[model samples]
Target: MSEVKNRIAVLRAEHKISQQALADAISVSRKTISTIETGRFTPSVTIALKLAIFFNVTVEEIFSLN
Candidate 1:
C-alpha cells in the first residue's frame, strides 16, 4: 500500500457514467469497480491495465504511490 489516494470514483461520477458502464468499458465485473472505488479491494496489475486503458490515462495517473 502506502499509495497516494485517487479521486477515481468522483471523476467517474463527474463524467456521469454508471459503474456498470465503466466495468463494461474496462472489461471487469461491476463488483470489481465497486470494490476498487470503495477501497475494499486492490486490483491486480492486469486489471489496473484495463482500467488505465478504459480511463484513457496512464497507470501512474490513475494510481499514485506518492
Candidate 2:
C-alpha cells in the first residue's frame, strides 16, 4: 500500500500555530499532531476533516497517499 503523507507541520508553521494549539482546536492530543507531522501515524477521516476545517483548507491539502 502507498504511504500517507501530510503537510501539517508546514501549514502549522505558516499559521503560526503550535502542536498543542492545533491539537486543542482539533480535540486530539499533541502527540497525535506530532505523529501525523512525522509521518508515523495516519489520522482517521474525522480527524483529518477536523484538521482541514481548522486550517480552512481541504483535506487533500493536508494529506495524500503516495
Candidate 3:
C-alpha cells in the first residue's frame, strides 16, 4: 500500500495554531494530532474532514498518497 504523507505541520505553523489547540477544535487528543503530524498515524475520514474544515482547506491539501 502507498504511504500517506501530510503537510499538517506546515499548515499548523502557518496558521500559528498549536497541536493541542487544533486537537481541541477537532475534538481529538493532542497525541492524535502529534502522531498524524509525525507520520505515525493516519486519521479517520471524519477527523480528516474536521481538520480540513478547520484549516479552510481540502483533505487532499492536507494529506496525499505517496
What RMSD, rounded to one decimal, does every model reach? 1.9, 0.6, 0.6
What is the per-residue lDDT of model 1 for residues 1-66, given as tens digits with 9 covering 90 to 100?
485455569768777889999898878899988888877777898988887777778877777664
Q: Write the per-residue lDDT of candidate 3 for residues 1-66, one digit (tens) a residue.
A: 899999999999999999999999999999999999988999999999999999999999999999
Cα displacement (Å) at residue 33, model 3: 0.2
The models' CA-based lDDT, in order, is 0.79, 0.95, 0.95
Better candidate number, 1 or 2, judged by lDDT: 2
TM-score of 2: 0.96
For candidate 1, report its TM-score. 0.78
Among residues 3 or more apart in sequence or in different chains, the pairs in candidate 3 whose N, CA or C atoms overlap within 3 Å are none
Q: Any runs in candidate 2 off by more than 4 Å, and if so which? A: none
Runs of candidate 1 with Cα error greater than 4 angstroms are 1-4
Candidates in order, TM-scores: namely 0.78, 0.96, 0.96
Least well predicted 10-residue stretch by lDDT in candidate 1: 1-10
